[model samples]
Target: MKPALESSPGNPLAHLPFYYLDNFHRVLDWIGDRYADLLDGEEQAFLAGFPALPQPSRALFVRMVMRKGQLFRASKLQYDEIGCPRAAAAPLADAGWVVADPAVTLDELFDLLQKPEICRAFALPAGLKAARKDAQLEALRAAHDGARPFSGWFDGDAAYRIVAKPLCDRLRLIFFGNYHQDWTEFVLSDLGVYRFEKVEFADAARGFRTRRDIDEYLQLHACRERFGNGEHPADVLHDVPPPGTDNEWLKSRRDKLLFQLGQQFEKLRDWAGAHAVYRECGYPGARARAIRVLEKDERYGPAWELLQHALREPESEAERQHLLRMAPRLARHLGHPRTAAGRLAPPRRLDLALPQPDGDWWVEGVVRDHLCRDDAPVFYVENALINSLFGLLCWDAVFAAIPGAFFHPFHHGPADLHSADFHRRRADRFAACLAQLDDGSYVDTIRHNLVAKYGISSPFVYWNALDEDLLELALHCIPPAHLKHAFLRILQDVKANRAGFPDLIQFWPAERRYAMIEVKGPGDRLQDNQLRWIDYCARHDMPVTVCYLQWTQQ
Candidate 1:
């Protein structure tokens, strides 16, 4: 007889069977009832015939199916660890599902768990550890059939071969509420190629028939492989039909794939392969990639030629910047060819002084004092003030809705922005939530989030000293027209732009004016993301400046 379900309604595991095999039948019955409409004709037929068999026969089938592997020690199903009566697995032996093997022993279980090297570590009887491994296994099997606590031991163990693995996996999922992650690891390991690593476009080319299919496939496989993986993309260009498939979306992906291929080749020091890949990439940065590869290989002639070609039609700011930076170095190698454009001058450094025995906080105070006084606008060298302010202001809309944003289990930040579909998936939810609120709501929400959720211990509220003044000033500085867009941009790429705001913000409540100042101390430089933010702010007519600081002898 099967183990009875508990009577209590409150227990989550109340309805579960005590025996693993009986639970398997329960899962099948449940799935058949719930998902019969969704299953195909073949699946429906299998479910229709499952229940009529005797209890032992049904239990045997379910156990083999749910257990993942076909083999098991017969005793596992028959008796509990403390010698309790469970289902007799005799029906499995009577049928072909389980084949008896007298040779099977505890040593086989050790091997199955991949612990054969530490077999002696197990607390077997005193002499067992010293005996030969084969002798120990044989002795243990004999002891099992003899009158020990391990009762009902047959001459040998029973083994199972899963004839229908996929069906069994579905049964396990329905019964246990999870597929066995370890049971089918070897069979399912290949999913890693399609999952946590980028699939070569060539490998996926045949599988993807439509343009959108290719795009989605590439997105799912965006996890880049480590450097020096000896794998190359198949020439997917010819495989993907370019004739009728003039879709711009497909073309764009093809271009991107080629560019990534070029980058991989460049990293591997395959200069010629990289150059070939880049030539066909058609991306703005492709020429730079090829040029870098050539330059690394000390092939200045080819590198200079590529640079000149790229200069004629520089596509993006990044391309232009690279050309400008590399031009002089490459020119030196090419015997300093004379051109109408004059030699590039070295960058000029600003002359400034710090107070004697400079600390970062001291410099911040000096700059703040230098910039502000009893004036219309208040100047604050607020290091983390703006970021903290934003964090507080956007707390309810962005952080509250997302679990683990503030209350993470391991105290780590949310998943990587570029990695996974994290930012892309959450961006819309974040944007829509943030857009619904007005200026007053932002202020009130910040206060609520600070006092209620974060309280006194919140890192974001550490600069609560300036919170009221900063909030009032920010109300003036943040443009009403672009508030949603600005906040959305910040949330959309939060991982990249969250922590890197400018150091100083001068606000004039009377004039309704403000300017962001990126204070660069001696040897400090603007990062790429900072430059991007500055450009973004400039385009929106938000006042921002980069201040270069230099120390002089006082």
Candidate 2:
């Protein structure tokens, strides 16, 4: 039979024999099927109309046609006809050097296309010829370099194929065959187009052998004996290596890997693993930071242990302070309130003298009686009665004892009194006294005294005569007005809505029925609206009280 391209003049494979065409048809069919989707209507029609070529030219034609088709399809145009071998084939055939085949399979064509000697028969460009020779030389070099007893036939045969097995072996050695396992498998397996039977089988076996060798090496060299038979393979793999090694490259690689692993662990909320990696890096700050992250997630035990370990390491005073602050909060969160309290050092003691009520009996004596005694009359007599009487008798003496200590002027000296310094001092003393009281009795006594004595008759008089400074100071020192307002608003809403006010609100003296309470100092007369509000409240059965203290009290 004549070569397939003998009818065409410039055919590159015009010199090859007919027997080589057996394998070329397989590659043509594969190209047609593989690129069917990408081909345009015109190209598909043209390809469909074209018949398979004959002989060695057929195999060569498949490769050249596929490559040109791919380039044309990619560039969306026809390519230059640099060396038109098909056109030259007729002349070569005339010289009785060419042959052709009538029928062939796509697989057979693929095999023939892969044979290096057959490929060289094509009328290739000078650059391509040089490249092909260089590739062959390199393949030979690789085969010689990687020549092992078992790999001899495989490597030598691959050197003659399109892809060299020896070069693949060298690559495996250089990269340890650890990187891109899937990619290497793809290139060496049935999935690859360069499928020389011997090379394919050899690569498959090599892959299996390499995997087994790796497993065996790990089992033999790694501390596998330390891991009981019950341990998981993954756990053994992870714990096998020591944190750091003398190999600087390995150590650096490990550090990077560990850091990346720690980040992933943190994302997974694997606090234990994250902390372990951080600890391995020997970065106390990072470890502490990881512990903090774990703590936020309520991984208490692990975070606590990590923190303890970090604390034991050499750390700055700032770090200690941070730990000190965090310990109490964490302890409280962990349901150890007492431990939290223990972490707080004792508060420094103040040097100010305690307020004495009257007749050498300190205010504490009256406050204590009020709290301890059940007798209402006795309680009033000791806590409220003595102070009320003493306040009315020698107001200065009582005011002097507790400066800025009363809630209102009514609780201290007279209000018509205009001495700012006296009121200021009395306000201060009253504040100090209330500070000592530290209970609800003081508020109750003041409210009860006002109601019992003044009877809400003139809310302005009760509020005006009250030590506003002392009242304000006392209130501030106690629960504070904003908190008091919140509590009162809630109580009022509850009462108004019939929700039932809390018992605590009833205990608050500020909630008592007063027409109007003016918050001002002594000698500070009521404003017109204040008087109007007082009048309005009186008419509406809402009593008013004024709460303020003189500036001198400060």
Q: How far is candidate 2 from the true structure (C-alpha RMSD, Å)?
A: 36.5
Which residue ranges in model 1 land beyond 4 Å of their true spot? 1-260, 282-284, 296-305, 333-472, 478-511, 519-524, 528-554
Error of 1 at 198 (Å): 28
Clashing pairs in 1: 70-160, 71-160, 102-156
- Per-candidate TM-scores read 0.43, 0.21
Cα lDDT listed for each candidate: 0.51, 0.35
Instruction: Name the 10 consecutive residues with the lowest summed lDDT in model 2.
Output: 497-506
Residue 309, candidate 1: how far off, in angstroms?
A: 4.3
- Candidate number achieving the greatest TM-score relative to the actual structure: 1
Tens digit of lDDT per residue, candidate 1, span 1-554? 21222233353443444344444455567556544544555556667765655565565565555453555555455523213212344444444334444243454444432223324334566666667766756766654543211112332334333344455554433323222232222112222211111112221112223434433433323322211254554343324333234333334445666777777777667888888878777654787888888888889998999899888877544566677678777888789774343222222233456554545565555666667755545455343555555556654333332421221111112222222234554666655556544534665665565555443233233443555566666766655444554565565445454545666777776666777777777777777556656666666666777767677667
For model 1, the local distance difference test gives 0.51
